[model samples]
Each structure stands twice: as structure tokens, then as C-alpha cells.
Target chain A: MTADFLLSRYPYVLIAVLFAIGLYGMTVKRNLMKKIIGMTIFQTSIYLFFIQGATKQGATIPVLDPELGPSAELYINPLPQVIVLTAIVVGVAITGVALSLILVLYRRYGTLDEVELLRRMRESA
Target chain B: MTSRFESIFLFVVARAMVPLIQVFAFYVITHGHYSPGGGFQGGVMLAASIILLRISLGEESYDRFPREAGIVIGGFGALAFALLGFASMAFGGNFLEYALAVPGMGAEELRYWGIFFAEVFIGFLVWGALVAIYDALESGGVE
Candidate 1:
């Protein structure tokens, strides 16, 4: 594709690549930490998607600037920013809770390797 | 599987990039109302930044994560949001009725303040929670 076409679609391409990498790691990695990394990457890509979607050509800052002439023709939408804020908080809370669970799992299994840990848990349980 | 070189280059780079990304994330969070970025995207970026740091440094280095400050930050964000909501009530409007809360404030100003407070909550939560999760895995691995 030409550069112009590429620029227009680049965000989606980035999002797709991010998703692919994350999914591959999550599915194939034997380490629990690796899997978590994958998940985080996956989640982050979605955030990127939302941010990109909200952006439009030639949009101005939502903040009112005195420098802009009284008849300036543009202002950006602030709604997406508001939505993303809540999503970020929830992601953090979920991360905390997930980490706690992982800790518990570790205490029980004595290992961080996901496959080995799972095997041990099966045996013990 | 990748070699240590790959890990050092890619993974370590990931780690190093996180803090920078996080600074940008904060910028995005605060400036979001005017730009394409917003609270959710910025918050996630913040979490991802720290998560990258953990990945590159390994879990042991997570002691660098600030627990108390994170908790306080998150609490403050939520508190700020609550206060914004309640400000409307105090100003003889329904809760979260930004338009009625302040006669002197423009409608846009009230909206911005309300949104900013909400975004602050997200920022704190993202910072606090991501570190917490990383801690969970790190502690899990070490023991």
C-alpha cells in the first residue's frame, strides 16, 4: 500500500500485531509470568484501539485555548477519554486481584512454571 | 525460544521503555479531554509500562514498586471523583450534574473537572493494581 493508505490504517495494523503476539505468547508460553505478560499486552492493544478510534483528522485539543481565534472551526471529542479512564482503573483492580491469586497458586505449588505447577496441583488435589 | 541476547535486547528494551511510556501515559491522561487520548488508554499504558519493567528486570526487582504511594494515589483518585460528584449536590444540583454545580464555571469547565477527577481515579488504580499483580507473580516465583 502507498504511504498515505498505510498511515490511515496503521493503527489497526499495530493493534492486530499486538493481539497476535499476545495470543501466541499466552497460548504457547509455559511460564505463568509469560502468560501474564501476554495478557497484559493483549489488554493494552485494546486500549490502543479505543484511543485510535477516538482520534480524527484535524481535531483540536478539548481544552479551550485562548490562542485559538474566537471563530476557530474545531474541537475534539472528550467522551472516549472519559470512558478510557474508567477502564484503566478496572484493569488495575483486576491486576491486583489476579496477582494475589497467582501468589496463592505459588504457595500451593512451589513453582512458577505453569505446566509443572498444574501437574503438581493435580496430583495434590 | 529466544536467547538471552534477545531477552536483553527486546525484553530489556521493553522494560526500559515502560517508564517513558508511563510518563507519556500521564500526559495523555491529563490532556485527554483536549486530545484523542483519555483516562482508560492512559491508565492501561501506565500499567503496561510497569509490567514491562518487571518483565525486563525480573520479579526480584519489584521491590522498586511503590506500594504505599500507589495505594494512596488510587484512594485519592477515587476520593477526587467522589468529591466532584458531591460538589454538584452541594451546589444545589443532583449528583454529577456538572452544569448546575457552578454558575461561574462554564459547562465545559464543569465537564472537564468531572472527567479529570474520574481519569485521576483510573490512573491511580492502574498504577496500584498493575504493580500489585506483578508483585503477586514475583512473590509467587521467588518462594
Candidate 2:
């Protein structure tokens, strides 16, 4: 990529790198908590990606402005923003569920390491 | 959740801050249609205030906002949201079509109030659900 293009497109690159890091953490991390943290990072990067798609160079919020004439182009696209907003809540809920499941697992097996947890589950089963 | 070290200063500050945070949350919910804040944002703020209290007061936070209350408030909010949709339906509007539901006000006014109420309901639901999740995590699915 050219230097000027890279400079202008840093946000997309940053989001991609974060998404890769999160994916690596989720897949490669041994600790369950670390995995959850990775999942959070992944979720955040996705949200950021969608938000970036909704951006306009000089557009305002979705709210109607009386001063400006009724032009559709005056506002940023709101659909992605709405979707991301809902996704954020759902992501938090998922995190809560995951953490609780982890808590139960730790209580049962006395371990948070994935391999150990798997071994203990097999033993109990 | 309890730790050995506790700061009386944090406790008092948390106590003083909770009400203000809650009031601001309410403002955010109420002005959501016209402002940057909204139901979900307000609800998160409400949850934050509770979390602040929980961490600051530790065990002492129980009587103030017991664990049972969380799920109840959340359920109530969800129920209210559904009920409002149903209420609009009963009044001959399709689900959530507020302009055609209530008769007295102008159509725009009716829609505005409908949206306002919906925001409030959503705020309550989110606040309660988050608090419940926090409580469950803290106590490990116990009471």
C-alpha cells in the first residue's frame, strides 16, 4: 500500500489487526478468562468496523436538523449505528453468560485452564 | 466480592454519587429522541451506579439493592415494553404503531409519547438485567 493510502486508511488497518489479535486470543489462549477477553476484543472490533461503515465525511447525526434543508445526505446512515447499538447490549449479555458458565466450571473443576477443564469434565462424565 | 481493605471515603463518596448518577440516567432516557443519550445508554449508566455501590460498600450494599430486586425490575421493564406494544395493538394499531393507538393527542404527539414510554421501559429492562447478571456472577448463581 502507498504511504498516503495507508495514512488515510489507518482505522481499517487498526480494526483488522485488532480482529486478528482477538481471533488469535480466542483460539490460542489457554486461560478461559483470557479467551473471554479476546472475545470482547473481537466484539469491539466488529462494532468499530460497522461504525466505520456508517461514517460520512461531514455528515451530522441521524437526528433531524431544522436549520438544514431536508436532504437525505445530510445525516450519516443510521442503520449500522442502530445495529451496532443492539449488538453491544447483546455482546454484554453474552459476556455475562460466558463468565457465569466459567464461574460454574471453576467451582466444579477447581481450574480455569481449558485443557484441565476438559480433562475434569471427561473424568466427571 | 468482599475484600479485606475497605475505604470509608469511597463508601461515602459512592453514597453521594449514586443519586446523581441515577438522575442523569433518567435525563438521558427522557431526552433520548433528541440527544446523544438513550434508553440503553441510560440503563448502562444506572448499572454502573449500582456497580459502583457494590464495589464501594461491598457486603453493605445488599440491603440497599438486594440481589432479588434486580431480576424483578428487569422482568417488569420487559413486561412493560411488551404490554405497551400490545396496548397499541389493542387500540387498533399494529405492533408499536403509536400514532394510530392513542386518540386524544395529535398523531405526532402520540408517537412521541409512545417512543418516550418505550425508552423508559427499555431503560428499566436493561438496568435490571445487567444488575441481575452482575449479582449472579458475584454470588455464583446463588441467591
Candidate 3:
């Protein structure tokens, strides 16, 4: 795309770039810890994308105001924020679980390297 | 690990800060209904306080919270939330219908209390569960 197009949709471009970086980390990293970091990055990009969607061009927050009254057009979408909130907790919970499992794996194999871990598993079996 | 030497400076600073953190966490939980924060955010704060203590003071830091207390508190919070729903149902109301849970109280007041209690329980559950997870990760006693 042209510079103008990219500049006009900077948030989207940023989201795409973040998504790519996260994907790269997840797929190309050797250490399991790095992969987890990549996974967290990927998740962050998705969250940012949702947050971007939740905003409106001219609308304000979802909170009610006496002057603004109860007009739907005056407020930004609230559902996406709620969704992101719940998703964040779930993400953290899963991340904790994943980290604990990784801890156990390292305890057993004595290595965080993905390839080394696989090799050790085979040797033990 | 538990074998690591304890730092007096770390312990003293963490001990001093833990109370402030917990107080703020309580404020966040209680004022959540009218503000941006709610149960999860406050609960995470509580867990973070514990984590700070754990990092600085080591195993002995768990004296206040304890390892087993995490799951117990979390389970109690979960049970409270569930009971709130069932209690409403027992009053011949649909699930979570707080207005019906109380026979004569106004609908608005009942609903407010219901949501408030829900937030409280949610905060407790999140705080305890997160602490438990952190403990598990730290211990890694999966023989």
C-alpha cells in the first residue's frame, strides 16, 4: 500500500505489524520462554485490535451523562471493552497454566531449548 | 529457591508496602461499582502484593497468606457466587434475580447489592486463584 494509505490507517497497520512480529516470535523462536513471549505479543496485538474497534470517530465513553442524555450514537461500543476484559483474565489464567507446565518440563528435562527438550524426552523414553 | 539467602532490606520494604497495596486493593474492590476497576483488577493487585512478599521475604513470607489459603479462599469465593445464584432461585426467582431474593426490598437496591456481592466474590476468587497459580509455578513439585 501507499504511504498515504498506511498513514491514514496507522492503527490497523500497527496491528498488522504487531501480529506479524508475534507470529514470527512464536514460530521462529528456539527457546520455549521466547515462544511464550511471542504468544503474549500475539495476544496483545489482538487485544489492541479489539480496543481499536471499540472506539468511535466522534463518540465518547459509554458512561451516561446528564447533558448527553441516553442517545446510542453519542457513546462508543461497550461490549468490545467487556469482551476484552474477560479475555484478558482468561489469557492470564492460561498463561499462568502454560508457564507452570513449562516449569515442570524444564524441571524434568533440565533444558528450556525446544529441540533439547524433545531430544531429552526421547532419550528418557 | 528456598535455599537462596534472604535480604533484610527486601523483607522490610516489602513488609511495609504490602499493607498499602492491600488497602488500595480493597478500595478498588469496594469502589468498583461506581468506577473503572472491578473484582479482577483488584484481585490481581492483591495477588501482586503477595508475590512481592514472596519474592522479597521468601518462603517465610507466606505466613500471612499461606500456600493452602489460596485455594481455600478462592473456593469459598466461587461457592459464594454460586450460592448467590441458588439463593435467588430458592426464593422462586429466576437465577441471579436479586430483587426476588429479598421479598420486600426495592428492586434497584436488591440488584445493587447483588452486583456488589458478586464483584466482591469475584475479587476474592481471582486474588486466591492467581496466588495459587503463582505458588504452583514457583514450587513445581510435580514429581
Q: Model 1: which residue pairs collide?
A: A61-B34, A62-B34, A84-B40, A85-B39, A85-B40
Q: Which candidate has the top score in DockQ? A: 3
lDDT of 1 at B119: 72
Estimate, for each residue in A1-125, the C-alpha lDDT of model 1 and write its tens digit: 68888798888989999999989878999887788888888888888888777776786766677777544346555577656656656665665676677777877777889879978989998
TM-score of chain A of each: 0.83, 0.93, 0.96
Superposed model 2: Cα runs more than 4 Å off = A1-5, B1-5
**Fnat per model, in the order shown:** 0.59, 0.55, 0.50
Docking class of 3: medium
Lowest lDDT sum, 10 consecutive residues, model 3 chain B, at B1-10
* Model 3, TM vs. native: 0.91
Question: Could you arrange the candidates by lDDT from highest to lowest?
Answer: 2, 3, 1
Candidate 1 local Cα displacement, residue B80, angstroms: 5.4
**Could you report the DockQ of all the candidates, in the order they appear?**
0.33, 0.58, 0.64
Cα deviation in Å at residue B61, candidate 3? 1.4
Docking class of 1: acceptable
TM-score of chain B of each: 0.70, 0.91, 0.91
Candidate 2 C-alpha error for residue B24, in Å: 0.6
